[model samples]
Target: MNCTSLQELGVDSNGIGGKIPPIIGNLSSTNLSKLYLNDNEITGTIPHAIGNLPSLTDLCLDNNMLEGPIPLEIFQPGWLTQLVLANNQINGEIPKSIGLAQHLSIMDISYNGLQGTIPETLSNLTKLGYLVLDHNQLSGTIPPGLSCSMILDLSYNKLTGQIPDGVAGLSSLQIYLNLSNNLLEGPIPLEFGNMDKIQALDLSANKLSAAIPAQIKGCAEVEYVNLSRNFLQGALPSSIGALPTSLHVLDVSFNRLTGMIPQSLQASPVLQFANFSYNNFTGEVSSEGAFANLTDDSFLGNPDLCGSILGLAPCSGKHGHFLYIAIIVVVAIAAGLLAMVCVVDHDLMKTRLRLTAPSIQLSHFPTVQGNATGKKESDEHPRISYRQLVDATDGFSEVNLIGKGGYGHVYRGVLHGGTVIAIKVLHQDHAGEVIAGSFERECRVLRSIRHRNLIRVITTCSTPDFKAVVLPFMPNGSLDSLIHGPPCGGKPEGPRQLDLDLLLGIASNVAEGMAYLHHHAPVKVVHCDLKPSNVLLDGDMTAIVSDFGISKLVITGARDPEVGEASTSVCNSITRLLQGSVGYIAPEYGLGGRPSTQGDVYSFGVMLLEMISGKRPTDVISEEGHGLHDWAKKRCLQHDVDAVAERWLPRDPPSVLPFGPPRCEMEVIVVMVMELLELGVACSQLVPSMRPTMDDMAHEIACLRDGTWRKYRATGLKAIDQTKSKKY
Candidate 1:
């Protein structure tokens, strides 16, 4: 019993490459607290008798190819704290009995093929500091009793349910709480708001629901908060306005919520990256102070937002009513002149339109091309003939009509040799001088850009009486169809019912495309109108940013005041022009006569959140006093947002029951949803500059997917191992 300590036993030196000796327990001594028989090619299970060592404190059997469950005898005692059985092929769960070790502190069973739920008994270790069970096959809820306060990372696991309320209240949680890409649910606990000592909190890609708690506003000491891809709702709490000025990053995209953005958030001077896109919000936007310096891409997708940011239209109604009346009179006079010209040349105009109608079945022609000739353009650009477009569209046949917009009707057509294309014809009644200028400007911008995300302009045709722009056909249709229409109806079946993965993929791709236009394109392009309808999906579900009618292509190195003034004036006119669809139009466009990229970012954020939550941003506004973005944001702050899941998930018996026979892992799915909500919250931030660039958005989504997939695979492996071990 008083045997001396066992010297370092190098198993690899003995050439013992086969199975571990079962009788090796004889080496155990009362004073043998440290056993290091690692770095060997040894195989087979550890001996049970080794557990009889009452003095054992450190047993590191790492870097070996050992297989089978850990010896039950080793866990029976309660003294061993530093058990490092890592880097091995060991199987089975961390036994619940191991929690009996009241003295255990550093238990790292990482890099092993271990399976099963984490033992709740481990919570009894009051002295535990670093508890890392990452990269394992652990499935089930995080034990609420886990006492470690510093760093408790159960990330990259199949754990489900909300982070237990008790766990969020842990006293040692000062550094971070990384529960990204898990099956966790429920709103982030408000108790976490009191953990002001914590630095980073990442609960992204989970099924957590409700709004980010206002309590967190009290955590002024926090630096980073990521709640992306969740079911969170509501406007960001005004309390967030109280965050430490040192806060650097915040993301809450892809959720259901809405409201007028708080001015306090927009004024935050320290925010570098923030996103609140794809949600429902409506209000006038101003880019003074911290917001003015940001790019237009930051505020894409919000139709009801407007400001003076670069790459965006000027706010509408900025000019007095006299100016509006003057413009209207000018347009009326121009219309009267055009009408007289039509009357004089009626026969010729009719004949020309008829001749070209066959090529553009979906278009009415006269609206899009009629004014192109009178306008100035670079002579090098090719001019398409209206007759060819008419011939392709077969005189705007009903069958060829794909969609209708306030500006014009979109038509599908085939050219002479079978070249399939889309034709966008402007409305004839709006073909006055002002409207014609907008048409020409759109065509000019579309012609110069060539990006996979941007809708390509194949050609354009203009005449005294007709106008049209030809584009390549989009087989997968528009994002609007998927987000707003019934999936089962229509030729393309509208938009497919998307799971969390698919939603994240589409949103990320759209963001990437937008980011390219705003930041990477040779000429900075502001996609002034980035609604769901403007996002087209191709055969493989690849998204292409479309609708350049409101797009602005800024020339590089051009500081001409005339250019700036003209662009600003045109943008201001367009904002007040009532051109965009009613609900999707930015608020400032209706009142302020300004359009900024921040407005677009807000719209895009709304679209993103709407897609993930399966709610209409407009519906949230009209039916619900609050919009979807605000609702989701507020719910995230609460702990009861999971109730919204009932609306989206199948309500059948098995689906509703928590632990039914046909359980479909709905809880896990909900966690993924919450992750998405967090993304939406980020995109919908009041401060446009707080939003992440589309490139960053895409990368975050990819990271979530990778983490989720790994956890899923690990869980499946654990189940297989458990069944096999039971049979033995």
Candidate 2:
């Protein structure tokens, strides 16, 4: 307590435990200008007495286990400039007296348990530049007068009411202003267009309504704008598509926005990614500039949209022209009848003018309902009737049947309107309630979770006697048929050889999809029946995971029966045996272990190993006594990417990957495959607890992808992206 002359102290990341000592308060060290105690395990409430230090300025206690409300006395010191207390257990409302430290340039208290409305006094700090209060339990509207000059983030909170005009109209935000994942309502402010210097703007996952303002094009430097998962309506502004040349990413998925996608987006020289999924967008998708290599992932859930893009039906000009002509002819005939009636009733109307009035109707006009939640499914999806399915599938004839499973049959169908879909029809002869229950569960999972590498639902039909799920027809088909060939006694689709690069890409996509199911989705999920068949390839050979038949939601797992004799036999014989994916089932399940995300990882690992080796896990299981896990562990020779490259190809390559140095490229491919095999072995270890989570698996796959993509560039090999379109 007598250390009055201490000028500086730093104890960051030292595994320090226990409480913030109470003695720290009595240190009236007037000379102490810097104090750092962040990245510790210290617990207990912050001591109010510490504020007695008259000259104490920099204090950092973030990334600790500190609890209770922020002490009111800490703001008494006018010399304090930076305060960091993020990633802690701190609670209670931010004290209104925070404004007392007017000299504070940075204040971060994010990722805490803090609650209550943000104090309006924040605006008083004219010098404040960066303010972060994200990942908290804060509620109430954002303070009307925030003064952060560079960055202001209040995302992932319970904020309510409309965003203040002053906040949106601020032109000084140079970095970004993120108010995403909140309850902000009303139209996006037109004043937001005035922030010409801001680089990024994110307002996704909110309840904001009304049309996007055309004025947003004024943001001359903005590169990213995310307005997805809102209630915005009307066509996208052409000006947004025509944003400044710096704009790269624009997301407007999961809204009610309608009409044609602006052609200006396709012409953007810098735009790399644009998401328009799950909206009411119509007309043809452009195939130029940024849209040149786009996949079906960008346009899912918009059935009316025709395009040259993969997975979308090609627009038929002859049929469309005749249809338009027919509609115009019908309207003309209706107008003629109405005119004749008006002329005949002119005299009658004058005689009865005092008693009644004539009402004109535009009865020939076509109208469609908006695709918002809570509306009938027919309104959002194309209205496909029961007879329509039968007609499309020709009464579920053998010629239309694409595949069959224990629980259902899959039929390839094309609707009269020229949309191709795969229909999974549940067997009516199966256990009635059990079949219905599984169908409902699959539908629930499909409808709630969405990702770029996950199969998207078209629409589902349910009836007392018949239940079916409709999904987009994957052009390249399932990974099982691609690598291992289709099941026995079926028409051979011919040999399909996947290169190491393509296989790695498919593995990465599957991992990403599993990560979404396990951790990132609105509700955590476990794809209990993950296997090669469940992983399908889209038109670009991009992987799309499908079939959530035996998936489990972690929150609702307790309600389901545990894996045992009662359900184990049924599960193995049905979803597993029917698909010959018993080799993909985690060994823990055989011992009655419950379904888990780790189990999904194990299955994915088995699939990954299979992709690299081009052999099934069950090929010689009985004779060999071990599956691909042991095989990979023994065959894979772990070595550094650079070391392997040097040993196999000593000559420096003139060019990088996807280009010259053919022998070096092949040898480098072998090294990457070995690395992936190592990952597979780790994931498929016998102990379920030893398996890496899907999140970790996804990250590792991405790292491997990037590492392989750039490794060749290190050996004096010039790397040039042929997709020369500039991107940030």
TM-score of each: 0.45, 0.46
List the candidate 2 regions with Cα displacement exceeding 4 Å. 317-728
Give the per-residue Cα lDDT of candidate 2 at 105. Answer: 69
Worst 10 residues of 1 by lDDT: 364-373
lDDT score, candidate 1, position 115: 81
lDDT of 1 by residue, 1-728 (tens): 33455533323212235776666566544556656565445778888887777777657676566888887688655567556665678889887777667766556565577788887887778766446565567788888877764446666667887787777876456545677777888888877866765656778778888887888875665666777778888877877767747455666766665776667767777866666666665576677755665675655566556556654445676573345457758979999999999687877867876786532222322222222223333333335567777778898898888876545678988776676789888655433554465566576566456567676666676665666777778877887776656332445443455545456667767877777776777667776777887888776777788877656667777764323644764684454333213234443343222565665666677787787666776445333333455657766525545765544553444322322132444565666667767777676654455666666766777776668744753564566566558878
Candidate 1 achieves a global lDDT of: 0.64
Q: Residue by residue across 556-635, what tens digits does model 2's lDDT show?
A: 44433222322443353333222223368775453334667778888889988887777777543322324677667644
- In candidate 2, how many clashes are counted? 0
Determine which window of 10 residues in candidate 2 has minimal summed lDDT. Answer: 359-368
Best by lDDT: 2
